[model samples]
Target chain A: DVKVTQSSRYLVKRTGEKVFLECVQDMDHENMFWYRQDPGLGLRLIYFSYDVKMKEKGDIPEGYSVSREKKERFSLILESASTNQTSMYLCASSRVLGGNSPLHFGNGTRLTVT
Target chain B: AQTVTQSQPEMSVQEAETVTLSCTYDTSESDYYLFWYKQPPSRQMILVIRQEAYKQQNATENRFSVNFQKAAKSFSLKISDSQLGDAAMYFCAYRKGSGGGADGLTFGKGTHLIIQP
Candidate 1:
């Protein structure tokens, strides 16, 4: 079985504060993704990393950035937290793209910005 | 760009009954992959079933199966003998084949499944 672990299951931050969400995968997958899930809108990709030090912007990448210093860990950074940034964040990893590989997702972190 | 659509936002079914969740996608490419992912109250996304465009046969995982209509570009999920544990948010997703530049899955808004007692 593949295990994806997120650093925090729940978090709260004040407006204008910076926040970090960490994720680690035991499968050593090459692809890691960060997504924010909101009610009615479903899950939207924020950022993704294909390899160490390589990152790409997804559909919704405005106030967020990501870091992949190592193969097993991926971190999502919120430059300036706002009330609108409060939502459930999910991290997923896959062996490689363009194959039959399916993404294994973490439990998710629900962040609240006040 | 590819887009997935799930028209039904919410659906309900009684125990021991069957329910179908509809999904439609628009893509210019001929080869791609379709998936049905379930997110329960625990907020963990689980792959329920997956279908390849090249294969005519529908994908099935035990009580979970997909009705894939290639030409119509529709893929719907059918859950048989619904249980309380089946209540969750079901998302429809589309992914292009190996040769495409886009590697990630494009997901729909999702349908919330409610199981009645």
Candidate 2:
């Protein structure tokens, strides 16, 4: 079984403050992703990393960035937290293509920005 | 571009009964993958089942099964013997079969399932 762990299960930050969300996977998957889930909108990709030091912007990348310094770790950074940024954030990891592997997700971190 | 849609926002099923959730998608690609994910109140997303577009046979896992209609571009999930633990938010997702350089998944507005005792 693949295990994905998030650094924080819940977080609260003030407006204009910077915030960080961390994710780690034990399976050493090559692909890691950060997504924000909202009501009626579902999960929208914020950023993804294919390999160490390689990152790509997803559909919704504004005000957010990601870091992948190691194969097992991925981090999401919120440049400036705002009330609108309050939502549930999810992290997922999967093996590279050619294999029929689905993403394994961590218990999401619910962020609250005041 | 690919898009996934779940028409039903909420569904109710009695324990030990069966319920089906509808999902439709639009994409020009001939080969892709479809998935149904269940997120419980704990906020952990779990893969319920998956179906490959190229395969004509529907995919099934234990009490969960999928009705895949390629011609209609429809993929529906059927849950038999619904239990209290089956109550969750179900999401339908689509992704282009590998080789596209870490392609991201497109997801639909999830349907909330409720199990009535």
Global Cα lDDT for candidate 1: 0.93
B32-104 per-residue lDDT for model 2 (tens digits): 8999999999998999999988899999999999999999999999999999999999999988776565464
**Minimal lDDT window, size 10, model 1 chain B:** B96-105
lDDT of 2 at A34: 93
Give lDDT tens digits, candidate 1, residues B44-116.
9999999999999999999999999999999999999999999999999888886644466889999999999
For model 2 the local lDDT of residue A17 reads 95
Model 1 over residues A16-73: C-alpha lDDT tens digits? 9989999999998999999899988888999889999999888889999899999999
Candidate 1 Cα deviation (angstroms), residue A70? 1.1
Note the Cα lDDT for every prediction shown: 0.93, 0.92
Q: Chain A TM-score per candidate?
A: 0.97, 0.96
Q: What is the C-alpha lDDT profile of model 2 across A44-91, one tens digit per residue?
A: 999899899999898999999898999999999999998999999999
Q: Which candidate is the best by lDDT?
A: 1
Error of 2 at B46 (Å): 0.5
In model 1, pairs of residues that clash are none
CAPRI band of model 2?
medium
